[model samples]
Each structure stands twice: as C-alpha cells, then as structure tokens.
Target: MNRPPELKRTLKNRHLQLIAIGGAIGTGLFMGSGRTISLAGPSVLFTYIIIGTFLFFVMRAMGELLLHNLQYKSFVDFTTDILNPTIGYYVGWSYWFCWVVIGMADIVAITGYTQFWWPEVPLWLPGIICIIILLTLNLLSVKLFGELEFWFALIKILAILALIGCGGYLLITSFVSTNGIQARISNLWSYGGWMPHGWSGFFAAFQIAIFAFVGIELVGTASAETDDPTTTLPAAINKIPVRVIVFYVLALTIIMTVTPWSMVAPDRSPFVNMFTLIGISAAATIINFVVLTSALSSANSGMYSTGRMLYGLSRNGVGPKVFARLSASGVPQNGLLYSCALLLIGVFLLYAEGDVMKVFTIVTTVSSICFIFVWAVILIAYLRYRRLFPEAHARSVYKMPFGIPMCYVCLIFFAFVLYLFSQDKDTLTGLVATPVWFILLTLFLPLYRQQLKKRISYTDSKHNH
Candidate 1:
C-alpha cells in the first residue's frame, strides 16, 4: 500500500535550527519587552528565565517523543496516536489559529515600524506590502521559505549579539549618564531593590512572558521535513538551553545593566530605545531594519507552521484535500497559499483600525494559551510513551529531565500562567475571548464531523455499493 500523503524530508539541520530560533525570537522581545519590564521591574529577568527553563523541559519531552517515532509527523499526529482523533483535530486547528493570530501581531508591528522611515506613510501601506511579500515567499517553495526564515532569524540573532556587545562595552567603561543613570551592575539591585514590585509582580508578568516562548516548538513541526530527524532533532533541541541563556538571559541582563530599568522607555521599543540612548548614529534606521526583519521572520514562520499543520491534519483525513497536494519542489503549495491568504486578512484588519494591538493581543494570547494546551499534550504523550516503552524512557539517548515529576511541574506552571492572565487586566481581556473562540469552534465541530464522516463513509461505501 502507498504511504499516506506526508511532507517530504527537505529541511536540513541548519534550516531547522534557524527556524526554531526565528520562531522563539519574534516582535515581542524587540518591542514588547519594555512594557513587560516596566510592569514587573527588574524581576522581569527572573520571569523570562523561569518560564524559559520550564518550557525547555516541555520541548525536551516533545523532542524525545518525536525522535522515538519518526512517523510521529507533527504534534497533532503524536496526540492522535496516543489520545483520540478528536484531540488531534482540536490541536491541529488550534495551532493554525495560533499562527494566524501571531501573523496579525507581527504585521501590526511591521506597520508600526514603518513609522521610523516615513512618518507620513500610512501604516496600512507597509502592512499590505509586508503581507504581499511574505505570502509570495511562502508560496515559492519550502526550501526558499526555509532560506528566507534562516536569514530573517540570522538578522535577529546578530542584532542581539550586537546589542550584547555594545552593552558590555558601556558597562565596562562606566558609560556616563544621559538620564543621570550611570551604567553599572548596581542597576540590577538598585531602585527599590530587585523585586521592587514583589513576587506578585514577578508572577503577574508570566501571563505574557510565556507568550515570548510561544513558537519554540517550531522545530518539532519540521520533524518531517528535517534531514535525519534523529540527529537533527536532538541537535536542534540540545541547543535550546544555550540559546535561551545567551539570547534571552544574557541579552536581557546586558540591556537592564546598561540602560537601567528606570531609563528604558515603556512606550517605545527597548531595542530602538536602547540604541538611541547609547548614542548610536542612525539608530532609528538600524533598529527599524532589525525590527522589520523580525516581523518578516514572524510572518514567514507563521506560513511554515500553518502549512505543516494543515499537511498533518490532511494525512489524518481532517483538513481540506487540496492541502495534501505537494509541488515537485517538495513543498505543500496549496496549504501555503491557503494559509497566506488567511494571513492577508490581518493586513486588511490593520487598515480598518488604527489600533490593531487589541485585536493582535486577543488573538495571539489565545494562541499562547493554545500553546500551553499543546505543551500539556506533549507531556501527557511523554508520560504515556514512557509507560508503554519504559526501556526507551530509561535508557533513551535524549530523555526528559525529571520525567513525570517535571511534567507535573510544567503543568502546574501553565495553570499558574492561566491564573495570572485572569488577574491582569490586559491579559484578562484576552482570557475572556478564549472561551468565545472555542465556543465558535465547538459550535462548528458537529457540522465539521458530519461533513468529515460523510466524505469518509462515501469513500468506503463506494467500494461496497
């Protein structure tokens, strides 16, 4: 019998690595970090690292599970095999929704970044252009998509390194005050001392801090397209920690130390604000380019994930049949076009409303919560995998640390994140919308089931009838 329609293994380990980094680092850290730090004070560092650490295990459990079964395909497939097909359908569509929402946020940001170049340019123009460009890149081919994402992500990684280097220079030279805030190590402990806002503030930031790590699982999505899923998967995953430390913790530390939490502008992007504060010539243009690249990376990644998710769903006989079609280049052209068309809606919405952040936040936060749900599924899958294959769990080359206990801890932390969203006003707004979206999805589920069953039953009945 022929194999089910599946994604070809086209992505190399390098492509997978950069895609993961691109997904992990997005418009959030570039622009949103200033707001997060302002809310929680210096303790925001702890917030990022803590959430990052826990998520590392979630990915580890997922990585191990994916490697153990090369046929696992995507998280949806893994969930389907262990759980039920219903859960797979929910998770698959949930992820697609997640990326669509994230694409909107990034497009909104792209328009916002346009202000740096031509203040007179209507935001919608750039937003529309960005959508067009990303859509084209995605529809081209999977390899081209990988290449675009690779460079988009590289720009971000380089930008972070540049900032880190600059910050270190400032700290070492005891850079003099622009805002009467001298550059020094004292910034970490200064101004109301470390946890200035207390544990409540620290925990409160987790509501959205978790959002920063939302796409870290993009690596797993590439499992099917990855060359040597075994070696590449583990290699890509093993670097998650080192990436978090250098890119997240070290970079955040340098930023806070060099600029001081008090000096960072909450209204402006920390990346742009820091460069301007440090007296970089042409700072606005430099940061604008980097932010533009960041936005492009987000949109590009949004397309990649949506395409793969659709492919996975189709293999399970859940999504549109066209999504199962692949081009000679080994890319899923139909899914790419379909997802890109949906993402273009974001550009239109940005045109309609001057303020798209509310829309972006509500949608993206739902996506983040969906990510939490997906992670829980991964852990549950891991726990089940261990039970069935104890030898693999015990002697596996890449096993999750702390096994079941760690899984429980990650689950509790996710629950705590949900609680934090409920308490915070900004996040609570997003939390309120989650149920409504699910209900909208749930209301359509029966019809979806009917249509799905009708098609399958027809296929089977034809042979007998």
Candidate 2:
C-alpha cells in the first residue's frame, strides 16, 4: 500500500501516552458509572474488573501485532493485511460509526456538565459550541491534538487520583463527620452487603460495566501516527488493565465504601455526589471542571480516532481518497472536520426537550454496539491472521494471548454481553441499536464499495489505456 504523502511523524511517546489514557478515562467513567452502580450495587466493581481483564488481552494482542510491523499504520490496515478486504471494510467504517455515536453521547454529557452552572442555558448550545471549538483545534496540527488530549487526560487522571486519595484518607483516618455519618470502607457491604441486590443485580450491571471499557481499543486506531510505534504503542496499550483497575475498579470501590452502596445516586456522578456528601461545596466547581475536561478528552479522542479511521478506510479504497489527504503535520483535516461535524449535531439533541437523555441513551447504546462489533471483528481478524499466516505471524513477534482459543472465548463473552444487554432494560439500547446500525451500514457499504471500486478501476484502466 502507498503511504499517504503528506503524513509525517510528529506525535511523541508522552503525547501518545496521554492520548491513550485520555481516551480511556472520560464521560463513561466520570458520569455513566452511576447507572452501572444503580443496577449492580456493590457488585458493579467485579463486573468492571472482569470486562477489563478481557479488554487487557485484546489490547495485548493489538500491541504485539503493531510492534511486529512498524509500517502497519492503523488497525484497519492490520485487518486488511491479516484478514480480508471485507473484514477491513466493516471494521474501518464500523469503528468510524463507533466514535460518531460516542461523540454525540459525549457532547450531550458536556451539556449535562454545564448544567452545573447555568441551569437555564439549554444543553444544545453548549454542546454545539464545544464541537466547533474542538474542530478548530483538530485542524491545526497533530501535535495540537496530542497536546489537547494530554492536558484533558491529565485533568481526568488528577481528578480520579485526588478523589481516590481523599476517599482513602477518609477511610484510613476513620474520619467522623459533624453530622451522624462517618466515611469508611465498611460502608461497601454494611448497607446492602456485598451481593446486597443478589445475583440478578450483580449480573445485570454487566451491560453497563462492559460499556465503561468501550474505548479501550482507541490506541490501536491511532497506531500509525505515533513516533516509534513499536515501543510507544506497547507502552500505551500496556496501561489498559492498570487504568481499568485503578480508574474503574478501585475508584468505584472507594465511592461505594465512602458513600455506601445504597447511597450512591443513579442520576448523579459518584465523584461529584461524594464531594457534596462531604460538605465540600467547592467540590462541585472542581468536579465541573473535571467533567468538562473529561468531555473534552472524550471529544478529542473521537476526533482523533474518526480521522485516522477515515484515512485508513481511504487507504483501503473504502472511503473518499480526499480523506486520505494529510496535512504537513500528518493530521487528516478533512476527516477531522467530518467527525467534528457529526459531533456538532449532538448539540441539537442536547437542546431537544423531553427525553433528550433517552435519545442520548439510544446513541450510547448504538455506540456501544458499534464498539463491540469492531472489537469482535478485530478478534476474528486475529484468529484468521494467525491461522493462515502462522508462518508469517510466527516469523514476526507480536501475538495475542491464548492465540486462537482466546478469540473464541472473547467472542462468546462479547456475545454474552450483547445478550445481557437484551435481558436488561438499562442496556437495551446497545442490543437494539446493533441491528439498526447494521441495517444502515449494510445498506451504505454497497454504495461506497461501488464508488471506491470504480475510482480504483478508473485509475487502473487509465494506466492500461
């Protein structure tokens, strides 16, 4: 495959590190977690851990493969080279759809976060403006994209760390409040007990718990642009399990401990609610900023991944050739604009009255389904790649753990999660949206494939003539 001429290596290890981390820690962890807790109670922590464990292996497979081939630009390219053109087609475009839906969810969340300050400001305006601002920043340079992700990620990391530290200190100190309450780890099981809500609830939360780990594949999508992807890519992907455990598991454990499983509100952020419980009015402001950064980080990641996917699809003759155009800085301007435009449409959803969140829930469900689809395809690609190119794969170093068996296991598990979504009302959208998205993509792909094939054929015919 020909390299995009204008593409350059500008992103460094730190930028990639922060960008990967940024993508993982966002509105899902900051806000959507409460819903999970409401469903599972104290058992939600275990659900996150299990899903995280599976995702860790997925990232490991991607990291090993990426490290093996320095020239392999993105996971889409990997899919094409390893599997077949059709798999690449589905994975590339589905991944693009994944982020667009996610971007909409994040933008709606931005409107929700802003409601902290101006209750009357109407959600859609802020969501729309936020997309416009991010689009401008993305057009500038890849480094700028990296920088934005870095700082936004930094804020999220700091907030989680601070919240964890505070929760820990309060637990350790056995801090007694002026009121009747005392913060302690004992609160986790004290109210409802470990399985307070019983097996059903514990299992029910699996839908949301898995969704928290949705963007774990993000680093794989941006593999091409990073400097020295071999070392940096592995370093970034290696952090998946740790972040999943710390940011999701440990953080939630703390919230459950301090606030009690029964006390954690379903509608509000556990982070923000904890602070308010501690009588820190100032915490609302701090958490507002953190959530804003979280939203920014989410949008930033959406922009980055969406652009590269476009570039990748174009590379595979699955999208517009113009999308393959890169800036001198190696950033795909057209791709960024395209993704950001969809993100801006999220604002209208935000502004819409009467069950806007229901729409947001629908979007999130669809996004989650899209994410699962891409992930499952990657696993299939890995399975096929290893089988057909055992020699090619063996000659190279990078490989997923448990080899082909892991692929089957992950498939069953992912399929089960999809099933769980159907069983649970909270995650019904994810299940329902899969067919809806599939119908749209199935219809859309034929036209694109035809157009792209024509373009390729025309170029080939011209040369032959």
Model 2: per-residue Cα lDDT over 26-143, one tens digit each: 5678777888888788888888888888777777777766665667777777776666566677778888888888788778778877888889996667887788788888787777
TM-score on alpha carbons, each prediction: 0.91, 0.90
Q: Write the per-residue lDDT of candidate 1 for residues 44-139, one digit (tens) a residue.
A: 888888888888899899888887777887888877765556667778988888988888777777877787778899756887787777767766
What ranges in model 1 sit over 4 Å off? 1-6, 122-124, 354-360, 447-465
Against the reference, the lDDT scores of all candidates come to 0.79, 0.77
Q: What's model 2's lDDT at 383?
A: 75
Q: Quick one: how many clashes does candidate 2 have?
A: 1
* CA-only RMSD, every prediction: 4.0, 4.0
Report how far residue 439 has shifted in candidate 2, in Å: 2.7
Candidate 2 residue spans exceeding 4 A from truth: 1-4, 120-124, 277-279, 355-360, 448-465
